[model samples]
Target: MARTASLSGFPEWLPQERVVEQHVLDTLRRVFELHGFGSIETRAVETVGQLLRKGEIDKEVYGLSRLQDDDDSAAKSDPNALALHFDLTVPFARYVVENAGYLAFPFRRYQMQKVWRGERPQEGRAREFTQADIDVVGDGELPFRYDVEIVLVIAEALSALPIPEFRLRVNNRKLSEGFYRGIGLEDTAGVLRSIDKLEKIGAEKVAELLRTELGATQEQAEAALKLATIQTTDTSFVEQVRALGVEHPLLEEGLTELEQVVAAASSRAPGKVVADLSIARGLDYYTGTVVETVLVGHEQLGSICSGGRYESLASKGSKTFPGVGLSIGVTRLVSRILSQEFATASRSVPTAVLVTLNDEDSWSAAQDVAAQLRARGISTEVAAKADKFGKQIKFADRRGIPFVWFTDAEGAHQVKDIRSGEQVAADPAVWTPAEEDLRPQVIARVAAEV
Candidate 1:
């Protein structure tokens, strides 16, 4: 069982629980590498100015400062104030800009690291959590194909994990902004922000906000609401949006891009991708295709994965880096998996074999046997104390250690399967556990439960 955190939102998993988390991280890393995304890690802290460049996330940024300062240091305001990064994308954009000279154009990279967010704690929301992100950034301009490719790559990664059914709902900012402009709404960003809250506040409340806050007419608000309601699993959403009688060059451009994404996804990932016009990623930096994913039957938990395209997030004077990316909320997904009993580790401990000490003086002999097993690629641990034979066996059993090694007075060796009461004479130099028993296994729960 996992222990409850003394401080809410900061999750600390127990050893067995950590096994599940590690398994998830390892799986993501393997899948990301297979897709040719090289791994990169940015520093935890970034200047306050750098972090705030992309969005109005000052409330979520955890600023850093000294606990004690000398008189001279306190007299002057620090020009470079720092804060823990709230997300990987902004920092990655900065990294690209800073390293533009050394990096090749159209760089592909994957980052898995902890990010701090100062938000209210909830079941799926954490103050600090791990995010697994993959992005392709290019110099000057990036291809539209990358937007579609990101969706497929993330779908493949999520499908590899033992999770419930998920849907990658996608949209394009150009489509949304153009639709708003088509209806004579000038504050497209303000309108997008309001429509983004449709799920949380509902259509009626969102329409009210658009009218009262953004000075939008009821007809304009209604048109935006109608656009937000359009959703489909294929390119059919193109007609659904067109049915609203809205037209703009940007809207048409967005429609073509989103259509390509959904059409390709239909053949590649099938039902995993959908054209969800309401997916307005609240972040201002996302300039094109935006995506938000939810686990089916657990939509209340919110997006387990999300990201979008950015045209100007990274730039140096005249050079601009356009990119498409996606990020998986690793901690949130793992927490849900464990709480719902979606999967479990086979053993709490990694040791495959526990070599028992015959006596206090036989410790050296037990070590030799353990070394032999270790050299053969088996995880072996010598008993800590020369307890009675039964006691040592009980210790191994309690830890879920399947095999226990025993040494006789004459140095003959025997191994016992604790779960099954079977003992066999074996050579430490050649004996090997079943392949499945070599390491901890992540066993998914039954289909019905999942």
Candidate 2:
């Protein structure tokens, strides 16, 4: 039998769930804008060469090809006759390069957009998902202090969201690079990538892959695994690793800077950020600091926030772009929140006061009440159906609408708080709801993420 066709690659939810998603996005925007980052959006596709600059991301691209170009031979054609973007960072780099003249140095911007990947979707992975990204691109040579700002803003943004428990894991590429080279391994990135899979692949097999495929001696592989597994709730882990007598100078510098970021963020939200040496952001490009955030109880879902510093991501007119930034995986974070039923939101329609239409003759009176409330900046909606008064109340109740306004034959208006099932006579022109009553809310989550 032919089954129902479900939407492929794309996922959506009910209105209340969407409200949660919107709240998360809005909080991100508020934080980014407060930090003086401008906003921008880039086109979704780039040429094949542009997309494959690093080669590692090519597998994730859902490539686009012209119908004519692929009609004769689909197998051998370059995918970018039109390709869906795999991530936003590449496009932003291209955007800055393309608009080099108009853009200012240290270009600060926030982007929220959907990116697609051709992957076998599972519990937390999605083929089509949204990412909220913020980056600062200077003409060249970004001050490392901006790395401090990136972590601060990301920690602030996630703190504003209604999530119970999350911690931003911090690391430095220079530390990893120097340490790997110090240990005499040339393919450090390959080793870092393998270490990234540590959470997915247990230590035993990872040790084997490191020694065999990554070409690490057994002792070197074991040390790398130990470094990857050494996670802590604070910066002391860096010192713990250093106690083993590692001799890389950059490792010392990485630890010092990571301590500064933790101290900065802890002033606002204590214990919400941590320095972990294992968080080698899988991408090879990150040149300085890196981050990976995991929810406390839902740690298995993995990092919901990730990005890092790339000092030379763009090139134009003899100036290379040096940038520091972070990307919040909107889809992944929202999905985790949804799966555990961890969020609450007001109705999506936002009709705070639904004016009742008692009958056809009195409909205009209800409309007047609605208009008056709306004029006062209250969200008001006139009941569409001239049904029974009981049915009208039921409609408002079904929507979780807080207040129901009724107009009697005498042209007097009354308001009811649906939650309390209480009503009172009030003048729409003179009476105002309490400020907190008007605002939408997510259930107060744990102030200190669990």
List model 1 lDDT by residue over 57-144, tens digit each. 7888787876674443432234367789999999999999999999987999999999999999987899999999999999999999
List runs of model 2 lying over 4 Å from the truth.
Answer: 1-5, 65-69, 72-80, 232-242, 246-256, 263-269, 448-450
lDDT against the true structure, each candidate: 0.91, 0.79
Clash pairs, model 1 backbone? none
Query: Given candidate 2, what's the lDDT at residue 108?
Result: 96
Across residues 68-186, which tens digit of lDDT does each residue of candidate 2 receive?
65363443255445677888998898898989799888789999999898877755678888999999988867888888889888888888777876898988877776677667777
Q: Name the weakest run of 10 consecutive residues (lDDT summed) in model 2.
A: 1-10
Q: Model 2: what TM-score?
A: 0.90
* Least well predicted 10-residue stretch by lDDT in candidate 1: 70-79
Q: What local lDDT score does residue 150 receive in model 2, on the 0 to 100 scale?
A: 90
Q: Which number leads on lDDT?
A: 1
